[model samples]
Target: MELTINVDETTRNGSLLFKAARTNDTGAMKKLLESSDVDPFIRGNLEETILHTALLNDNKDVMEVIVEMVPSLINEPMTSEMYKGETPLHIAILKQDINMVHYLLQHGADPIHARAIGSCFIPGPYGQCYYGEYVLSFAACLENEEIVTLLLKHGAPLQAQDSLGNTVLHVLVLQPDKEMACFMYDIVTSFVTNKQKHKVQSIENSNGYTPLKLAAAEGDTQMFNYLVQKQKRTYWTMGTISYCVYDLTHIDTWGDHKSVLDIITSSKKMQVRKLVDIRPVKELLHHKWKTFGLKYFMLWMISYIAYTSIFTAVCLYRPLKRMPDNQTDNFTVMIQKTLAESYRTKGDYIRLSGELFTIVGAVVILASEVPYLARIGPRNFFGNASIGGPFPLLMVAFSFSIFIAVIFRLLGMEQESIPLSVALIIGWCNTIYFARGFRMLGQFSIMIQKIIFGDLLQWCCLLFISIIAFSSALYILFQTLDLTNYPYFRDFQMTLYTAVELMMGLIDFPIPYNNVTPSFIYIVYVLYMIFAYLLMLNLLIAMMDDTYWRVAQEREELWKVQIAATILLLEKRIPKFLRHRSGVPGITLGFNDDDKWYFGVEEIIPEEKGKIQAGGIHMAKSVGWEVIRSNLARIANMKEYTESTPF
Candidate 1:
């Protein structure tokens, strides 16, 4: 007779032979665990293996059977079940089951296996995995001597931090009970070796708190003495970072601004351990000093000479004072005599000087850009160029225009005056350019604002369409009415101009009121006011406000790029000798191949064989780029939703 007793437990979720351990049946559990057909170590829906349940029921016979069968299960952390992500050893220690803990440890369990992969519950930075819930951290939290010793002898790391950034020492200092405090002190004295002391004690967790600082904050005097007696080195390696707490006296209890020494010692009056690096600022200053001192001075000398001479020529022109045909004065005679003294004939000296300086300014523009322009195509010139590309060229054109305008007017030749329009444009462009030099008032932000011009252009197109709609209606009305005397609405061009200007309350309606108006015309006027001024105007304002906020979010990165561009442009104007040298005064920090911080932002070194070699994770910025890209995608999806949705 075949004894066919069903040994496997079955449910709707799946079945395992873990039920053999439920009745504390060692022989049945051993047979199931060793059976070729039955997988006794399989975890269930709650991520509970048979070993976890057996440990809860204090079945040492079942626990040993499973450990002897499935050795990998010794280090496998539980996921989402009771005691989430805790290895069997951690749970055994927590329960004070010394034998079970030793059984798992002796089976080659990982001493530093913090948690299972892909089972993180604590949120950290994107593209990074945070391994929280260290077993040592857990055992130290229990503050038992045996548990602590067991994990330490197995070579558990003291540096592994939990979800809240608490180290093993951080957890140890929290136990203030006299008996437990001694146990915690013994744990600290056991493993903290000499070379690792400064590194271990001074390591600041995410909250900028060291173990000593945490103990001080908790007011644990015994733990404080335990740390101080061992921490012989008083001084700390100092640097200015966002989070570092030093001498506790002067600093506030909580902030990224204080140092570790600021948190523990009572003498907060002591100067903080400082590591200041100012090589960048020093180099920038030296570059500016020499650049402005030599090359910039030469450019300005020519520019000022042209500006003053051209200005004086215009100021001395007779047209400015409106000199009459019969008018005669000693002032005119004296001006003529002054010109004669410098020349062989009348107007020769003034003309020559005006042309000379214009040529000087024109040459300055060409000299500054021709070398760069020769190397790259015009498309690249515009693409990689800053705002108002080839701008000095415009200044050159303006100078030459004035020179031409003066000659034409002096010779009594009939021609269009170029100086008036060109001078105004050149002056305004210069004002915009100088704004880059002094961005204190943020007036030059248009340079940065130019990047999101596409978004702004889309908004302009919407406003333009609205304007065209309102103007078209008005054009039809006034054109049909044949209102000849109404200059503001005489044609579609004038009508469109008035339609835009009317929204701002610049143009009053009911024009040509002296004559009688049709009733339909008045009706059209009211509708135009409602649609154009009331509705469309407000809609346009909302779009502009939204655009400004989007632009404002990325302003810092935009400014950084603009600053880099401006530095490049300025560097081109001066020679290498006049620029900064590393050994110059105040330039203490070495400028070597390792230092790639030239663009005003740190360079990113991608992960090389799974190691972050840099001091910081280099940011690829404008936090708003990711934000705006997602928003644009979301908006695009919104359009599809509108198209698909039922009205």
Candidate 2:
């Protein structure tokens, strides 16, 4: 049964033949192919040929027929002006058609061909084409191991380098799969050994780094250990000691570099020598003593003075008023009663006075301890019990004094107010002193801890102190005014106290002010609170944000170093043809004005090419009033400025 082929002569006009090929009309397609009048490779205006159209549509049958009819078409190089110089094979690879790949390869398709072999593949229809390599690289990235192996086995050139001089091994190393990495390692190793006839020594990538360096930078303990021990025992020995040291510093920058190194070194019992020979142990100890001793001594003296004063005041005054003698007890009682009366009349004054005294006392004490604290590492601030550290103990004593004062205020005991007030004064002193001395201490603590308190704990503590102080003052006020007889006064006092306490509690818990209060007083209070909160929050957020950003930036730098290391390892494994160049490896890809890739050494685009380039301001020349009026009149005549489109 002979099939009669009906020819469409108009198929050759523009994209008619391409459209027919895309549609896979075998009879019409065959008629067009058999007709010598029609150029089998006639491309559309967009440079899309019949084969390209067929490949774009994934029409395997049409492609097969075209290749079979004109075998010469398989060898003809299409200008990138059409399909960017990508052959039918390149299109098939880009389309990820394994069947088409097999067919094209069988029909003399060159897998190793590159549109722009040494430069970044440009995506235009008539520029450089490296679609096949990119497609393969992407496939490897997706962990399609079978397809990768198939492409390699079918003369896909395992050693084929990209514009960046990156081989398949480099791409595989970048894959986020441990299994894939291991598989790639095995395949690459096997290929290298078989091809080179000797075990691979060093494998540097386009970035002048070996695979070992990449693994080290990545903190990939298993891969690093395997490469160092299994592949080349001297791999780690080849680099300068400074380089190794730099690598070690970067370890903490990436994921748990220290931990990874610990695992590997411990397992292998590797003895890591110091990058440089340091001073003798005794010398180091002597130097430390000389440097820190005087500072510690001064701090101790200062701490002693502050501690002694507060301790003396609390002990002496507290016991004196409680003595057995009625004269002393009466005198003390009178003094406390007068102070309470004063506090009731002027609450802000009392609070301010207490705060001032506390701050002054704390400053004197902390100033003394500063020398000692500064000598120690900042992280030691949080460590349990300093061997000779008086700061922690002094802090505890100061806190206790404040606590006692709070109790006395709450009890409304007349004699106790003296000691209570003293304690409150000292507490503020201690807080201010510690804050001033430990300028870097907070940052160091956060860096080491990486905790985000969001000001919750600090605010809570402040709120608690404020509420207690206010409540005690209010209670004393009610008693002084003798408002117990007036029900409204009693109710109002209790209600205001509760509401203020609630506000204080809400503030401490970091609840939004708007959520807690609706009244004008509260609204004003909230506005003030928010202003203060924002001021403090801005400082705190700036500190924490800077710390976080610095850490992240450091980690990124470490990762790049690790990538360089891994590339080095691969370089030693691959052949000379697959290796990267000396200076900036040929594979270093950078962005253009449009964020597209470009070859050659990367340089930052001029500001004019950036998304938001700066331009000189254009100031209009000043016109006289008459001139302006004339211009306005002329413009007004152009169109009526209606209400809908008012000029």
Candidate 3:
């Protein structure tokens, strides 16, 4: 007899209308809807409406009654935190109830504007696979083409993006399996007009990832290929001379100034094969080199030359400190040198100028490292001790060496020679960093780097241990025998040198029948030779060979990574205005209508056209403006003739 549903009672067992809808009880639902006290808009558990409960129960008759009597409740969404923003239509799609979905759509259930902003739809722990906010986006995420079609038929916009700015295509690309994404891509693109399709595909999410770039970033090569194939062409091909034009904006830099090269190279999930082998990316890199990379690379080379030249000149021109005869009195010489007031006579302008330049150069070089340290972070720059890489640290070391030499020179000490020698060695060795500009040199440098860091480092450790073990044993054994006869084993220092000489075959075997020398010493020497020369040396060769082969496989990727880092670093150093002026712009090919290629403009040299095909190899030599204009004119005329003549 009490028609009004209590809130507590509703929380426990849902409202009377919701209960009736759950059972598909048509008569009880009719009585509930008729009762003025029973509000049709009341929500039960999870703040689900009567329509949502009906759809959950598949109560078709109850849903039909509620739609007619309480039309306002049709689009009413769940108010519960997790399930909020989910209307009856969104629920029906989730339920996979086609008839109910259609019936709700026929009435007033909105499919286009209705968005589900529930916790489950958002990108978080609640749901790893974000279905997006819009109803159509949800259907596309489910991979239900039929339900998606139904939503589209009811005026659901494919161009509509969710709260995250991801369209249906963007969501599809995020799915683990890209097959459904490709299928949905074709379906969705077909559903929209040409203009709308472009907008839908190119729409960037909050992270600046267009669906295509997202696929590339995700390493979904199949999905990326599909998207590329679909969008790379603006029109159908015709005639014998068909042309293919590419959209640079689709493949090049997008979202946060990241290039296609940047995305693939920096992605931890992307395989090295994908980074080096992808055709478009390879082309993009080539375009970059031709456009701005060559100039920047040359500038870096000039800077390096200037840098190394300054240090080399300083070390060469630095005046040597004169010492007195009877240099054997090293303590007296050191004391004399320490007491000397002036390093230079103050008359040697050459030494003075050299020291001044050296100081300036060292300071300049040290200051230059600040940019690199800031970019890579001081932690990584100084922390990484790979002798082959860490270009910044190498420069830092070189600068400090010069500084040490300069300080010693100022103090009238000969100690500057040691640091000067070190600085020269490091400065020249650092030239390998510039070798990345050339492919062959870059590969060779990487191989050498791998060998030194990998095989050679381990070999040095083993060699050191072998020398220490053998030298110590030989010293102890031969220490008791020698009275200046065999000076090689007279002490630990001499014995250690002897161990090295023996390994190098400098010392002959079998000491001239000295009975005082323990027979056990010969046994130790033999074992040392066998372990060090026979086993360890061969093992070192094998390890080097293995490292060489391994590096050969990854040669291109490593080289490209080096080059990419250089290119990015160079870009950062350029003044923002000049850099923007040199920025890659949208290139519009004259023959390819008005669709601009936002990547790079390619030019073919007219004089080089004959040389384009030589020795059975067709080289795509895009160079000079004349060739591009010539090709464009020929293609345009051919297209015009083909169109006028008809099939």
Candidate 2, after superposition: displacement of residue 492 in Å?
Answer: 50
Error of 1 at 527 (Å): 4.8
lDDT of 1 by residue, 452-519 (tens): 24344565676688778878877776776656667788888988888778776786883888777677
Cα lDDT tens digits for candidate 2, 1-647: 12223234444343556767879877778887776667776756555567777788988888788788867666444454333455666566666777787777787876566442322243246434332244455445555566566666765554555655555555555455767766655654554443241213233456543455455444455555455333211101112211010111112112232222222221211111120011121122222223332344346447645655654454334322234465664544333333344344454454545455655655654554464445444544443111222334446556556555556645655455555555545444433222212324323332333323333445456655655554454444444443444222254456345535445344242224344322443454455345434544465567667657764544332222222222222333234443322211111111111211111111132233223211111111222334433433322221221112110
lDDT for each residue of candidate 3 in 217-300, tens digit (9 for 90 to 100): 877777776776564432212232223445556554422365555565455452523644455456556645655677889887
Ranking by TM-score: 3, 1, 2
Best-matching candidate per lDDT: 3
| TM-score leader | 3
Clashing pairs in 3: 603-623
| Range of the 10 consecutive residues with the lowest summed lDDT in candidate 1 | 268-277
Error of 1 at 26 (Å): 6.7
Local accuracy by lDDT, each model: 0.51, 0.43, 0.68
Root-mean-square deviation per candidate: 19.4, 26.2, 9.8
